[model samples]
Target: MDQTDREILGYSRYVVLAAAFSAMFIISPFEYAWSSMSGHIGAIYGWSPEQVALMFTTFIIFQSVGMLPGGMLRDKYGPRWTTAIAGLFSGVGILSIALGPSYPLVLVLWSVGSFFTGFIYNNAVTTGNKWFADKRGVMTGLIAGAFSWGSLPFIFPIRAIPASAPPETFFTVVYIMAAIIGGVSIVAALLMKDPPSGWKPTGWVPKTKAIARPSEHNYTVSEALKTGQMWVLIVSFVLVSSAGLAGMSNMVAYSNSFHFTATAATAAAGGIALANGFGKLTLGTLSQRLGVENTMILSYIVSGLFLFLTIYAGMNRSEWLFVCAAILAIFFWASLFSLFPIAIGHYFGEAAAGGNYGVLYAIAKGSGGLYGGILSTMLITQHGFPFAITIAGVMAIVAGLILIPLKYSPPIWKDEEAAAQLNARAAVGRR
Candidate 1:
């Protein structure tokens, strides 16, 4: 008989789940709330829109790239120390922005903080992979979803801060936010640990009903790299992520460009946050039934269609329609976060999930960040929002089509092991 979680760890795995969820929640504002906060930040710092946008790009670049090393560290040393240190640095990094540092200095601090955000993120989501093999979809969705909607409390207040608000007023809010982020993170970090290798829930059997089964063999990072499937996943991730990031980073400005009222724009931003969070959970659950690959195909195509609709609404100055379409766009777009990690865990095996997914995530999101921030911005400057957003939408649709051919193949070792065992069993039967 398999040992229960209580027998092995002296507690329910939900304890670890709560810790991972909380850690993800606290760090959300670093990305999700940025658009709402950036106008005020730019106003106070006497920076141009271009400069503020570049800072956001910087954050994305560091945050995505930092995941690889962070994942390797977590896989090796465990989550406790890495998360504690990340929490500290992430807090200080955001707080430093309120001190009115030079542009370059603020960029350096934000980059450092964003780097650790990756650590917190990698630690939090992979908890589901480590602890809940049976419930990977639902658990990962919940944790990943937190990274989006957790920004809710911060977004409205940040948006409410008047353009003419005094620097001290903004600084006070920053100080409070920094404290909350650091304090919550440290507390959550204490509760995290990886399950023993090959751990599974007591008496659990792998379900054939689910679309993707757990792999029988573990593939190391180098072995996984040689597969065509990994490269396909990378390309698909980059396309959808670029669309999502562009929407998240630029929605407020895009709304303003359409001459929408402040109230309407704020509503749209809030809508994106809420929908983005819920989408991960909803679609993640659905992926288990429909299969991850099939879900990805549907979600990406629908996400692209919504983006095009969003552009139409904006162009027509239909405030509510624009808000609705943007919400829908993000709802589907954000599922990539939940789905991709589960897909990687399924394909490569959970043994090196953190590092393998980290490598894929870093490369894809890094490129997406560059395209979403710099390239998209340049396109908007020259061709306007309609053209830039259209390009993003088309990319998303193409990404979905790219997944039609992806099917599972066993890792190399699985084949070898099966052949060797078969020969030995044949000889024994003959004897």
Candidate 2:
């Protein structure tokens, strides 16, 4: 706001963004690499696909659970300390997972790692909004898009495997991966914090006070839940986002089901990562111009159609078609990430965006954390990818429709009220 504050913001934002991007780089790879270890893990641990899938299910459960508290911590204490504590916890968990002596230990370690990883995204989004108040949508999208950083490390591992090798070896590799990935992520986490406006980039501007005005009237997390629109966001995203997560969590396996080798399937999954990152950046920025609600609707429509296309591609067993369909699928899928945060900023203002978005994210992603793994495996086992992907696709269409009601609705807080509210919440608690 002031010249000194602007300069500080201009310089410090890069460190903040890097911290977020790095976290994504470490944790995201696991999504793409999961299937590669499936067969090997199954052999060594002597588990079934249902069991292995449940491993992911557990990760989701913990991650969803962690988001609310993580966001609240970030909201309460600010970005730096929250991420630092989380990183410490995440590093320990991942290390434990990598060194697991038994299957039960692996589950415990992985769950802990997943919960800590949840801390990074919450801080990253919160920090990004703090960094670029003027360009909230675009900036948020860019940061959200960087979630593909998760996919970056996975390409190599997914490609290196020999089909005949046991799944248990894959587990060992993941364990090693857990140590390496977790280590780097912990280091990255050290550099993160919320920057003052105009601190890092010269031209960077905070989102207009109008677009992201904090409520002068602060709402407790409980108070926020009492609003009418909160349920809309929760129910809508839970239905639609579950489909996206289902696809993301299962992309590699979904491709394998179509007859591709694990390596090839992994590569295709990376493409989804690429699309996800790009979609977040593109759609997030686009929301700035088209409006968050409109952009979200479009993302839903596009993502749904592409998901259905995967079914068609599967039936034909056309690698190119499948690849194309999957690539397109990422575009819409990634947009969901950006839009959710941006919309929260729009509806709630930045005052409680961290906590507000955290709750919605908890519901949407948490449910996916459970529902997606089950749905993906069940659908494929019973009706197959066509049936599975089609169902998800329909949910996306409905998810897009969820935004229709927001068009006529105004933000829960106006500008003058927002400033007062945030100042109050930022103040102190009564004994």
Candidate 3:
């Protein structure tokens, strides 16, 4: 390509990335912000804690299940239309909740919204994989990090809602959320496009024996499913993600149980949110240097340690220690957001990133959600928070051990350069 073409590619790639970041940020309230709304909504509706938690489980189940078809659509038709559709679903879903007549209706509407948001999430992550193949870790981290911190803007406002506020205030906040999520998502979706096959950034060069280049060959979803490594990765994903989800889904409630004041508890939750964002940003970049798997191992182990410390903080009634430990645990969880996508692209090839990774991620998240949301709630109610935290910590440590086997596995696909190098060497031997 000439200078003009390079300029166009450069401009389009960066702009699309920016748009993906913005979309992830706007759409974040659909998931992460819900925790802030849960207690108030429960109080207003005269629902029990378990009932409120069931709504979260409903949202998570649909959100994860929807990613399969949503990812297929993005791979086939591209992100533009799919993301626009997601924006519509998100707007309508949030609005319906604001005007919902009953609790069941609210749950259904939220689930529908969660389902569509998967489109936005998958499209954004896949875009980073497609555009920044050379810088996959950093770009994926930025997208995930945006998602990690996106709830910050809404956290305070949502938390401020009194147990018995006028319904108008709640409706207004949701309405504003709908508009921002819908408007920004649609705009960003329109701006995105996939780079042409075999495209690379200007002035970039591939290794003579490059391995796992998507340009040479990509794994189809079916083909990727047949790999043992994929299964291992998925199971590991489920275990670690479940731990993170459990902590995040119950962080506020856990703080309250420790006798922290409402203000302090909410602040602790915010601290968790910040830790999530910083973990993605820092660890994502760190993965580039340390390797994604190595970084994941470190993240999981450290998180497990801090999670155990959280139990100690609760026993000692040290709010600061509790908050710090909670933040570190959450930080490790957030790192997975970056690591998994990057690993998927490397293992499965970027050509089928949207579909293949989508399938794996959906299963991982669906199972993890169940473990964290309803299961954690059950454990907390019956065995108390300490037992739940112990389970989560053990799962995190187990996840790290599961990934240790991957160190010996080679890339599933060989790039053109690597194939050619092998062929040339064989010819020399024959001569």
lDDT for position 57 in model 3: 78
Clash pairs (backbone) in predicted model 1: none
Query: How should the candidates be ordered by lDDT, best one leading?
Result: 1, 3, 2
Question: Which candidate should be chosen as best, given lDDT against the real structure?
Answer: 1
- Give candidate 1's whole-model lDDT: 0.86
**RMSD (CA, angstroms), candidate 1:** 2.9
Q: What's the lDDT of the predicted structure labeled candidate 3?
A: 0.81
lDDT of 3 by residue, 1-431 (tens): 52332365556578888988987888776667767877767766677888878877776777788878888888888889999889889777777667555877888788898898888888888876788877777889889888868888888888887866787888788889889888998899878877764456777664422223433467889988887878988998898988988888888888889998787678777887788878887888787777777888899988888899999998999988888888888888789888888888877777788888789879998899898888899899999999999999999999888898776673455465588789999999999
Q: Which of the predicted structures, 2 or 3, would earn the higher lDDT when compared with the native?
A: 3
lDDT of 1 at 244: 80
lDDT of 2: 0.70
Worst 10 residues of 1 by lDDT: 407-416
Model 1, stretches more than 4 Å misplaced?
A: 209-214, 408-431
- Runs in model 2 lying further than 4 Å from the true structure: 1-11, 95-101, 164-176, 180-182, 195-220, 261-264, 414-431
Task: TM-score for candidate 2, please give it.
Answer: 0.85
Report the C-alpha lDDT of model 2 over 1-431, residue by residue, as the tens digit. Answer: 34543365444556667777666566665454554445555555567778778877776777767778888887767676667667666656655534544778777877887787777778776665556656777778777776675656655664576667655545565556666565665676667655432233455544544354333344556766887777877877887767877787777778877787655576676777778788888888888777777888888887899888888888887888888888888787778778888877666656666788889888877786565786678777888767777888988888888778776674455565577687888785542
